[model samples]
Target: MGLTFSANLGFLWQELPLPDAIRAAHRAGFAAVECHWPYDVPAQQVAAALSGTGLRMLGLNTRRGGPGENGLSALPARGAEARAAVDEAIAYADAIDAGAIHVMAGFATGQEAEAAFIDTLRYACAATTRTILIEPLNSYDAPGYFLTTTAQAEGIIAKVAAPNLRLMFDCYHVQLMEGDVTHKLERLLPIIGHIQFASVPDRGAPDHGELNYPHIFAVAERLGWPLPLGAEYKPGGPTEPTLGWLLR
Candidate 1:
């Protein structure tokens, strides 16, 4: 079978109904669709949309609070609060039957923060049946974020030693932060549970970017990684027009 792909609805529009965006993704030829936070829409509504379009919910961000709000994985100092947050996210995941949750490691203020993130991740791994993916955001996009390196995320996953916990490998962020994407992907394939991409310079369609997506996809295929490749890019225009490269 061909690799399954998911379109991120967050990048699709700043203001649009989730169901409509998902239907549009189906029309654009995506097998699945993801969103940042689906809390805006009821879980039942999201489920209905998925059923209506016959599209799967790839994943959703567990970080709900504002920018300054240290996510569950980053606020280990406030252990109770972090656990509560993880519980809330797990409940939502159960409701929507999501396959994964992108776990953000909030601001990295100090060593204490790192410890907190580790603790939070361990808790989340134990609590959720769905995979918990640790994303390494580029410092340029998210300054002070704790888990910014694939290596660091790998180490954390190793320490936890939980099969359910894995890395959310974003090609654009890794290209910006690490550069050697193919090598990194090869090295981290075992630990990586999810993959997302955007064009390098402008965060637009993959074909227009500096990265070689065909080669990347080929490598992924060669590696025999049985995971969905997330098309989490900002479409330069309508989703269909932007996806011509992939369809070809």
Candidate 2:
């Protein structure tokens, strides 16, 4: 099969709510769907939509507090809150049958951040059977973001040593922070739980990106990655019209 694309409802279908977006993705030919955060909508509602449409829920992020908060996993002072967030994420994942949870590491630095991250991972592993993912966000987009590179994520995953803890390789961020994506994908495939893509610099659809998604897709296919490359990009226009790239 070709590289299957999962619709990221967080960026797409801005006009519609979660249920409508889930249906829209099904109608748009996406086999799976992922979102930034779906905490507002009840998990049962999202699950019902997925169940009705037969579209799998790929992943979702833990609640990162509110407007000011990016993440809690790495915050040294928020250990209790971080564990609670993990529990909440697992609850939603259980309801939706989501494949994984992207455990966001908030803006942090120094040994405390690492210690908290390790603690959070250990807590998550014992808490749920679902995959626990950590992604490296580019500093340009998420300035001072605790996890900023594959190497840093790798080290945390190593120290945590949880069987379910895995990496979330976002191509857009990776390309910005470290350009050798194909090599990194090949090397990190074992630990990469999910793969997401958006245009480098613009964070738009893959067609307009500096990176050649087709070639990258081929590399992912060759490496035997799980299906559905997550399309975590903003549509320049409507969610549907911008999807012509998927047909190609």
Q: Which candidate is the best by TM-score?
A: 2
What lDDT tens digits, residue by residue, belong to model 2 across residues 51-128? 999999999999877688899999999999999999999998998899999898898999999999899989999899
Q: Provide TM-scores for the models.
A: 0.93, 0.97
Cα RMSD, model 2: 1.0
Tens digits of per-residue lDDT for model 1, 10-125:
88753568888888878878888888878768888888889998888888887545656646567655677767767877788788788888776777666787788888888888
lDDT of 1: 0.82
Give the least accurate 10-residue stretch of model 1, judged by summed lDDT: 63-72
| Pairs with steric clashes in candidate 2 | none
Supply candidate 1's per-residue lDDT for 138: 88
Give the whole-model CA lDDT for all candidates, comma-separated: 0.82, 0.90
Which sections of candidate 2 miss by over 4 Å? none
Residue 164 of model 2, lDDT score: 94
